[model samples]
Target chain A: MPLFLRGVALPFNKGQAPDADVLAVSATGPVYIPLAKEEADAPTLCVEENSTVAAGQVLCHVDRLPVFSTIAGKFIGTTMVNHPLYGSLLCAVIKPTRSKRVETLPPVEEPDTDTIIEAAAQACIYDELDGIPLADKLRLWRMAENDQAALRSILVADATENDIYGSSAWCILKEQAQEALYGLQMAARALRFSRYHITTMLPRNRRRALKRLIGRENVFTTGDEYPVTVYDDSRDDVFCIGIQACAALSAALQQGQKHTHTILTVAGDGVPASRNVRVPFGMDLEEVLQACGADPEATVILGDAMTGVPCQNTHFPLLPGITTVLVMQSHAVRTPQPCIGCGRCATVCHAGLLPYEIVRRLENMHYERLRYLSTTSCDGCGACSYVCPAGRDVATQVLNANETRGTIFLNWGGVENE
Target chain B: MNNITAPHIRTEAASRHLTRDVLLTTLPLCIFSAVTYGVRPVLIVLFSILSAIVSECVCCLFRRQSMQVIRDGSAAVTGALIGLVMSPMVDYWVPMLGAAFAIIVVKAPFGGYGRNVFNPAAAGIAVLSYCFPQRMFTYPIASSMNPLPTGMSVGDEVVTSLSLAAQLRADATPSITRMQLILGDFAGPIGATATLLLVACAVYLICRGTISCWTVVPYFATCALVAWLFPAAGVSRMYGVLAQVCAGYVLFTGVFLINDTVTTPRFWFARLLYGVSAGVLVMLLQRIGRVECGCCFAILLLNSIAPIMDRWSWYVWRYVTRFLRIRQEVKAHE
Candidate 1:
């Protein structure tokens, strides 16, 4: 091109600030303190009764939940402290509500271990007789639970179970199922199998317990022509138990259910003591921090000591994407060093481009030549930068060299940190 | 509202950067061309580049668009390519005029860059070869061999043509040493003569990731395909492909010129078509017709029909897809 053409400049990235009012100075610290084991012995009282706090500044924060501020303040703290998405609220938060005043539990809705185990055992017996994935067994169990709901659910969808269960390894197990009994009454059936080849599972022990309790052969584990006995008198109750067992069993077999409520194990040497406590999903980290008594300002929120995203704020919704939220002092700022021409970029590039030569091109302002070298083909897997002996931000540099577009969102020009 | 980018970087893959890399890749050639022929060719390239940019700018202005042509590095490339095809020792003003004619008439008037029909450089060379044969080949080329200490020197004539080597084969003269060609001990184009220099630039371009070896490999392979099948070098047919490739700019131009994404065919078969035809052209021009300047002319001619070939092939593909769909529907009905 003739020397007259000029290039347009793109806007640079501007990160967020601290708790110094959004309209005013953007504050940038997260001063806080981790609640220690020794703190249990101290006369625990509200630390921040009412005080405006800076980013990471303590507003009666602690590692555990169930605590309030002795001083007066608003909170600005990260929530991920070892446990992601939720907090493990061990102690009382609302000053231990009077147990006598609050009456009644939420109705023993799902049943305890023994009854569940009994129902679960029945479902397993049914499974062994048919050798099907839990979903199929649940379908039959649900039909037996409420015949009206079953007809509605099945008739609303005209496709057959075979069609739904595509040809997969699971189909092999499906073939072992007893033939479908599609009359006014489904037939009682069981799969034929030689018993006890693989021994000492739950069936052996549960059978012994059930026999002792019911006096008759109450357990249905054996392939005795019919895995389930049709008891006319107790039909509804039996169906209920079957449905309960099926639901519980299906939940267990699910492959991809994520952790909603989790136990935060705060037991690192860096932490005061190792202890596990349950926390709800999406609980604010400031609430847990106030409970733990850590200075949010000094604590650096690390998702993990290894691979973690560093950010200044914890007000963002907690996501399962993070693993750990370590609280430590921030690392010092670093400047990039010039490439020593060590040829490390060349050695590590998977596409096999001489990236050092590429750097030379960039240095020489030959910006247009990068493509023929397969620079666009770079996957940005970070292997090159991760292994770079010079520790140059090689990955970041490569990323900077390429142009790609992503979704856009609102940025109310200079959003003041709250 | 807000735009965030991880440095939304443009690929050199665009005509812009591809054009720039082509310029950079051909820099040694340009310097060699200028030095050998004197700065007349350089002046011509400079004028054509300016004219192309100006014409593109004028079009962009009339269309109320930003002039992207210059930033894309295409106009400069067209100019340089024209400069390469022209003779070294022409009077300074002729190249400049040819460049103006090439850019204004061949490139910009037809919507510029990717939109142009004919190869701008080739058209310019064609025009000049007809208009001024004296300037293009005044000095007997069989006598320009002594290497200048710096740039391109025009002293007493020397047997400098690489075509001389091709022509030498019939006369049973000892073939020009491969080392001399590769290392550039002999003389030819300011840029294209040194097989090694071209290789180094090609390697740099390939490593830069602008061009793929797919086009490069296949183009030469197609050229060699015919050569290989009929042993022209008196060796085994397999070795004929290598011999044909190693000789002259067949390898360099096959990898670079015929492989140009914008002008060249895109689909492998279409590329094969381009390659194979170009191969035939090169063979006929060199061995049969005995045209000294075959590579550039073959490429320019083939480039003219590349789009039509691609479109025709795509039409065939679409027809097949539609036919299959209809057949499936008929079977279902039955």
Candidate 2:
């Protein structure tokens, strides 16, 4: 493949308060915690309806993975709730009580690899972006130690915020650099990888703070490009975990805390000011919007502008792995016109695939030709759609081709192909 | 509330905006043509634009497409291109005929706008040149042309001039000075002349990102290379290259036709190859073809091979890399 620089530099619009201190929003009302993991089979519920449960109490289990409650309250009857990434899921609602009932795993001092892995499993820690349970990921990396793969494995803490209006990851790295790096080092030690790096898109001065915390060489900076952090490097041996997940892992091992609270960047034009806010999982979207002083009439997106899921209403609960909550006014939808063949889409495609050509083949149902064009190489960054003069969803069309072919292509390799 | 897909935001430059930019870039050429060849060329351009819009509307009605299709302004650009390629001395109806053929035959029949395989403007100009060779090739002397309103048809009082391409084909040294050719003081097509203005417009378009420099640079380089390697009789190699580049619709074709987004290859390497091949073909056609200018034919031919070029260029790169890798493995083993 031609080694052209792929990915577009997205404009930063973190609104008026990108550098503002993070606000902590406690759940004032009932929080609905989804029982099943995103895209996974339904988990078995272990709690009874109307029973009192302490915070960090185990509520459900998907095989070996445990799902914990984020609030100490009465366990209400289960109900179907709309999940931002996953569709409607059965959730157990917990109304916060004044009682300070809490449950947490015992903290381990200078924990070894087995102790860290057990603590991660008990704490229900997950990689914030990939939605994969961290304990299982550790097991897989540990297994890979015996494999004779030529590429050396490395651990990476991805602090690069790919969202156009996201600053949560950056804020986490800025405030919790010590804990994040410590967590990364712990994971690397557990995986038997000597090299670990932290990647961020922060400006030089801010990056200097991170570089100071974890020696200058350990912190690598990338441009403010969308999907830059997501691009799979030529060597596929690198294991990536979100910066927030690193912080959570650190908290779980050091403070004996549960991975419950998530830091999210609440931004867009509809809010009075954009700020990073830490809210517990299962909090209502309405409460988050109100905490951010957002306009209720504006459209609420669960993620950033590009590749975000638009919420139909504010009734849905905030789910894990959500880095941004954009409250912006709805723009007038333009009627899509015929493709003028401007090639603007091709210019912004980071995968080096001609999106317009793939779109043409898709329109003609040329499935074999689409394969020849490496349709699966598309990571669906949505840059092609953003730059298309014709308002065509070129990225979505390639994604549809992938769906039709039953291929689960990620960056370079697919689950089926493997 | 709009339930749009992932990208809720879009860039400001839509298809209409691009078309407007293109039209804006051609304004300097139009103004220069009006000053040199009088108001007749401007009138031809306006008439051609009107004819194209009308033809597009008719085609839309017949094809049951929305009237909003014309709002993209592609037909206007096509019409302007068709008029610019015609001689300033042709009858007013000649441009109208060319515009109609461009829209109805070349553009709309292939599902309109971006779907057309061949560039409508180049195809239209080619058809006009084929059917009306006398009107298309003949040009009035720029110095003798009336500045004010005159008869639409070629008047007997005006003196005619031979184009530089025809002179080169006839194996005669150009009577015009090098400065005159650079300044476009001699007779040629309406907009293809004004060599300095065309160069300025090309630069502006490239800087504004309305056209790709990948295609434009390689095309001119190849044309200059070919012309220098085989200079015309009685002319120096450098002058031959300059004359070939500035005269006979060469610069105009490079600026507008070959760099067209719809007909050209999308990949950079394919686009580079397309430009070089187009330059070579235009030179060959100018040397032996019956027409005074062969740019339109070359563009049409290049347009047909663009998809194949896009596919093969990728395969070639892949094979070359694979070959290099295998050779490196052998070297390391040895």
Candidate 3:
């Protein structure tokens, strides 16, 4: 095993190893799908209120990207909901009706590069892990490869599941290994990449099972650290995609289906046992928690425990790209304290940035020195805050410094003078 | 609902837990000192702790801070450290005044607890040593068992003697056995004399990760190197190394004051350099300086320059990496 100099060895929460079967969770009430994707232009609504709409029908358009609905129902008036990525987004509320009508794109049997890209765009397949549309990522990769002929691209299916409490990627890879690998191979062949690999943090038995499906040489097992999959596009020639995205792509191209459901890992102290469930888009978060045997009154977070965003309103509808739901007791969260300068924060930082020093400089308003500290390298993994004895929010301080500087120091694979 | 940041979970050891661990490690040393000096050291330590708490409480109230700041137990640690470094023959007022000074002058004004740039205990002991050099350097015989209520008067001829630090400054070979040195049977500061117990405490703190070995190991190694290269007038090289390590506040400061989280450098490389330079400074002060509290002064001096050292170390790392990268590119082209 290669030694990772940074990152903390967080304790894996007990009973977090979800079962291989993905339980299907349907909406018990009206589902709300956000109209706008994160960082995209404001979407213009196309459907009217109370209009009969089928599942997999486009309801709005943000720039050239289309937003699809997963529920076959009537389009009630739009309501404001707290979006997981973009705060306070206008969502189209759809009341479920007794219609079985659904719309899907034509399956491409012999998909080339353009056909796959067009299929991805039509199916509304977004890489939830990378927070980018699949079609755009494909186009960008093709453009880069074409620009530099010597730069060989590698497609990496990132199944590392770097979070301490979630196993959505692991469960998906275990149950649908063939589909995930086939999706990766299809993308690599279309993009004309040199090779493709699947990286996971699974144990020996699970990894061996995956190795059996895809040849053993194609799988790479990384260290089970909190943040082993930080992607740097400027420096790396590798094109990374989440494992669930690959599975979605395969479903879109092979089964002639739209990307509608997401695999979510529901696990925390509030639940009796952790389970991986296939939650359809626009499902209520409260309904998903109740179905997973979690208390509705408990504090609900919409991602993994380390980097998850806490849900302010449990009534908020589930959105795509949200992989984990951490339902923790409200009392389990402790109040932050002042820094004691133990240096444990610096020791556990995966980016090797001095979090305490950054905090000190920020407090003193020493903005000039922060650039030299390389605050932009911080990936906000929360490892520093996890290991801090003082309970100080050192990770947030470093991230805020990154924002204040407003400059990302990209490593372009060359030496730069200080 | 609590809308906290990410990392909803945290490690178990908080600042209070770390302070409790440090206090627990000092218990053995305190007990050993009590047994050696017949309750005099115990009274001094308790009084010092009491005064430090009272002083911090007053400072907090005056500054309009919350009373919860006192619950961290850092004040008591500083007090215990001050008491440990003092001569057991001194009156209760000595330790009481030192603890008050440590908390009020060195700690609270700079912002209590984690924000203090200089270590309160070291600064307190250094101030006391400067004010009362005659009373501070004098030590009663080890295991004297004289628990007299009144403080020992200056120029009293009842078994009072020069401490090992003073003897070394006067250029005389210490008339002590290796066993006595190891077991702390010689006349020195109350808690600092127990070389064996202090070593065990250092090991425990290092194991618990409450203290860094990067600071402690390099400190002792540099001191040993200096002592080996230049032995005292009458002692052999090996004897000088052992005597210098076991004498005065060398081991005590290495285990406690220099390893203090707030005053020391944050990065490991800077800490390594701090330890090495502190060792050299301590040795130089012991050989040439007039004061007997050489370790305390050495720690204070290093604490002042710690931030600069941290910044310099970063620059050095950057330059070295850039140089190596350029060399690599040149080799690749060739």
Candidate 4:
């Protein structure tokens, strides 16, 4: 039996991601290919300052991986953009030549591992498995293959949504079950992994539907927990991927299609309808919101409500990694209250770390004590912050401790030794 | 743009909502006390709540914080609890001072609201009990013809009144019957005396997810077990447990004060241990000396050790799981 992990049952409105229709937003404005903000060194640009480019053409290269444009456009220029993972980066701007034109490459015959990997790299398929390029994933898989005994199993986390209002992944699996299944098969066959697990927290009805698509023996139901969005983290060898990414892989292998379009679930109280729409990559979020009839005053968040980062600039392009866009009425920002020692944070912590104690240690700069407590175990799930009655930003504090643990220790400079 | 952290939204019940729910949950006890004692209790409650709110506002002004912090309803809860724990016979200034002290001194000085290490109301009651023992200990007796209004002054109409704790400590046989003690006919704290009503409100609070059963059940169980095993004044185990629980603020403190979200442990096992320790301490303090409202003092003492309880709970949980793993391995080998 698959064990049910310790997590708090959250009471929020659960809405299925709209999967019935795919509404495409026309690419009217300039498209931006944002470079990773963490890199101190600027990425090498493939196209020069005033070059015209076709859709699916390489705009730049970061760490030797190509960054492709989703629309046929003229190389307008570079502009500073607030990158999601990092703070800010210079984005290569491309003004779309045509709204509907999507460039494609010839599909390789007899789709093999290397061919698929190369096509994925050329097509700019970013797999969220490690939040790395597909090419990197292929390299990692190849390295893992050298020592097959080290491989435990592969976990396909088909648990469609991370938050109460999330359901896009479920919708994708429901609509394109065959493609997703084939993609999973191809991944397993390529890696030559015998043991694999498919997990979902979908209701019985949807589970039944998914079972028909991916055999019942492969499916294991999980409880309704927020942290289950990330598969069981205990098994370090388990290579987990979203069902949509799996389907995208199969599509890239079978058809000669590049990763040009992405399906986004625009839901919450701010929009007129909760929709699952197929939008071309590099299309502005504002255009998608206008199409969805989102409220002008509503706050637009790029991802689920629980752990989604608030979009400071909605004018930014929606990339392939962008999945859920929540447009909801802005609630009053709760001033962080004093820690009540309620222990609710500890209870809801999926990482099993005492968030309150760890945060206290972090705030006081007690690096050694935090290390003793294993503060780095935190998965940055934000479950602790979500359940805190005192409205403390618990996950952020824990995340700070994990990220800054090394810097703090280095800065200590043998003070304790004295 | 409201550029907050990753969690764009929060749990529906914020600290304000929770405090409001706690205030609402105490309604039944308030109503029962008003009917049984009189309007004096209500006035005392009103005065305390008003003073607490004013003191909080004043503190907010002094601290240069947004006056909006008072809107979280914590000061109101502190005020209401202070009033409930006061004797109706005492002057109105007693509750007013208690509420102000609870908020401005015990709560605000420690850093407002959730930062306070002690239960504000309990601390207020403790200070009052120490300073004005005579006034704080006095209570109005209810008669058959006219149950004296709770807020009314102590006069000839309320002639014969005995403080339950004083009477219990004096001798084995109490002036009031066990049933009367259960029904709260004698002089005691306004809300604390209403045993049945307080219990009902506690159940309601637990059901509403405002409080946890882990805190209450283990605390009560521990109290009952201790009182039963070591009877007070040669009384039977059951009767002794009833006397200990009913005479003082044991149940009321267990349900509200110890379970105060700001001061208690969060883990279920830690909470259980916290409850057990608090119950044991309450009984130990009661046996040692004449501490008026021993449970309140016990709670304050135990609140300081809550983090320790949490740490120990973590260690024990790891050990237990490890032991279970070893046992399973041994079984498989056999």
Best by TM-score: 2
Report the lDDT tens digits of candidate 4 across residue range A1-418: 1222666676645554443555666667777777656445667777887777877777777766677777788888777776554557677788877544566777667766677677777777776433456656655665344554435556464544646676667777677777777766666655666555566777778789779877886776766777663454443356666677667777877786777777778888998778887776767788889888999888888877877777667887776566788997877777777776667787777656788888888777787777656677787778888888778889898888887775775555885566
Candidate 2 residue-wise lDDT at B51: 100
* Candidate 1 deviation (Cα RMSD): 19.6
True contacts kept of each: 0.00, 0.64, 0.72, 0.82
Candidate 4 docks with a DockQ of 0.49
Q: lDDT of each structure? A: 0.42, 0.82, 0.81, 0.75
TM-score of chain B of 2: 0.94
Binned by DockQ into CAPRI classes (incorrect, acceptable, medium, high), candidate 3 is: medium
Better of 2 and 3 by TM-score: 2
User: How many clashes would you count in candidate 2?
Assistant: 0
Residue range B1-334, candidate 3, lDDT tens digits: 5458888888898888878877887888889888877777887888899999999999999999998888899999999999888787887788889999999999999989988989999999999989988777778888655643445332364477788878777889889988898989999887889999999999998899888888899999999999898888888888778888888688888899898888898777788899999999999988887787788899999989998887778668656666876776566445
Question: Per-residue CA lDDT of candidate 1, range B202-270, in tens?
Answer: 677767655555456556666777676654544445544545565554655664666555566543445
DockQ (CA atoms), all models: 0.03, 0.58, 0.57, 0.49
- When candidate 1 is compared with the true two-chain complex, its DockQ is 0.03
The ten-residue window of minimal lDDT in model 3 chain B covers B147-156
Q: In model 1, how large is the Cα lDDT of residue A401?
A: 54
Highest-scoring model, lDDT: 2
| Model 1 docking grade | incorrect
Report per-prediction Cα RMSD to one decimal.
Answer: 19.6, 4.4, 5.4, 5.0
In candidate 2, what are the lDDT values of residues A1-418, reduced to their tens digit?
A: 2355666667777754557789999999999988754435556678888899999999887676677789899888777887657778877889998867889888889887788888888888878887777888887777355544313567889888867788888888768888998888888777777777888778778878677777987887766666674423433366788888888889999999999888989888899888999998889989989988998789888777898878777887887678888888978777777777767677777767788888887787676677677777788889998888888887788798877653424434665557
